[model samples]
Target: MCRSGTAMRLTALTLLALLLTACGAGGGQDAQKGGRKPVFPVQVLEVQGGTVEYAISSTGSVEAFEQVLVTARVRGVIEKVNFREGQEVNPGDILVEIEPQRYRNELEAAQARLDKADASLKDAQAGLKRREDANRQTPGIFSPDEVESWRNRVNSAKADVSQATADVKIAQLNLRDAFATAPMAGIIQSRSVQSGAYVQPGALIATLLRRDPLLLRFTVDEDEARSLKQGQQATFTVTDVDQPLKAVLTHIAASASSRSRMVEVIAEVAPEDRERVRPGTFARIRIVTGSRDNAPAIPQTAVRPTERGFVAFVVENGQARMRLLTLGLRTEDGRVEVREGVKPGEKLVVRGAEALKDGVAVKIDEPVQPQDK
Candidate 1:
């Protein structure tokens, strides 16, 4: 009985030991599976060196190179308005015509008066010659006083002829002024006269504006104005227009405004772009104030705002590392200039930067593509 009892005790002890060992093994497997690290998918881009232009952006209005207010030069009833509203006209193009019948009659009357005066002067001269001949033929028959009087009459008739000639010329000039012509080549902006309307001298007729090689008027701050020079190349983009127009800097104001501390600038658009752009259009100008030939640049999206300053994420040794950067000018195409804390040929994580931090291991799914310079 004692031996059987001892065997039962030994068997029970062996079963308990086996059960404990199995439990320990199961705990070890669970720990091994739970200790696996989580991985995150990330994207990256490369840092590059290229030329970067620093520009000052500004808004401005478009203006014509020339603007003129057309006015009537003579008073008359408007017979016809030759030009329609907003019509393009060349220099010397007839825009308005006043009733010329009255002027013509005046001119004819003046001519008639001139003819009569000329006839009277001829008659007076003939009479003076006759008197002089009589005095010569019959000595003491015709007095010297009578001959002198005839000469005086001829001189008076000559003066009348001269006055009539002057009047005729004045009348002809008035007739020509009855029609108003365009002073310059431009488009009619507004019309103030109509057909059959009575117009007076110096009355408003129309307004004309020249658009070819249009002028863009913009204002810049004092600091920006100081950086600009005449004849510099500039580019302008019209509001809601896709393409940018190239222009040349024409004028820069020497004085600055007291209230705004800004100087005015004028840029001339190319002649070919006149059809696409018009006067009084709003546009934005990008002037290349300065440039660095070899500056490091990165995609603007890669930059992240941090408590300290601007920062970027970089992949180094297959791990994410935070790099603080000093930023420079931003380009029009959404790229930023990097002055410090980055090197050329270094890989930068442009895509997945928002989810990354320092010392995080990452598996690069694809190689980073090189950015364009």
Candidate 2:
């Protein structure tokens, strides 16, 4: 009876083994048909060699090409203020009119004195001619001494006439000085006087400034200024401006500042874009101190800041690969120059790289062309 019971248990155990083997084979088939390795979706950018600009960032201000302080040349009461503060003016435009009555009176008086001097000279000449004629008609009628005295009177009268003529010219000039005119075309930066105000000669009245072809004033460290050159391009932006504007380096200080060790730089804005910014406007400037042709650069977004420095993800054979980067200058736009690591023509994962590991399965879209550097 014991042997029969043992045989039944053995058969039952064999059937259980067959059923387990069949179930395992079916599960393997299901995995082959329906299950696959997980893949991370990502965007890819193919690196290409291009000119990469290295910019030095700094804060700066816009300034007028030329600035002048308008001052009164003649002292008088301000009779009429022809210009308003911040008004636009042209060359020879009337700015202010001082009281002209006194100058006019002076001019008229001078002219009358000149006319009297001319009449006296004419009388002196007539008397001299008559006396000379008497000497010719009768040698003794007028003595030589008397004739010489008449001649002296004429000469003195002539000197008086010359002095009176000079006085008339001076009075005329004073009359013209009573009216102040613009020396050049510009906007009035300030105004200091109004009607009925008395001003002395050389008193500050207004300030004028030329706005177009504006100057961009900035400074750089002495060490970095070595790469700066005349006519090199730079870009700057101000509050409320949507896009960066251009300027050209026009002036570079011959030496560094004694106090700060900073080198002053000046850039001129293009005439066509002058209206977009104003003098004294605060601006952020990017000066292209240096450049490298055919350099590899990547979009700033593609870089991952690690504890060591920075890392970027690249795609290779459907896998994500992280690369340690030795970076160079970052451009004004969101691009970074790669001094080492990652060669041109490599596929860099620009987006969807945050979740990447050094070697992880990834499904990438076709590589995109990087923007021109």
Error of 1 at 229 (Å): 2.0
Q: What shift in Å separates residue 335 of candidate 2 from its native position after superposition?
A: 5.3
**lDDT tens digits, residues 93-181, model 2?**
98988878888999999999999999999999999999999878887798889889989999999999999999999999888888888
Give me candidate 1's TM-score against the actual structure: 0.72
Of candidate 2, the 10-residue stretch with the lowest lDDT total is 364-373
Query: Between which residue pairs do clashes occur in model 1?
Result: none
TM-score of 2: 0.69
- Going through the candidates in the order shown, the clash numbers are 0, 0
Off by over 4 Å in 2: 1-51, 132-141, 289-294, 298-327, 333-335, 345-373
Candidate 1 weakest ten by summed lDDT = 364-373
Per-model TM-score, in order, reads 0.72, 0.69
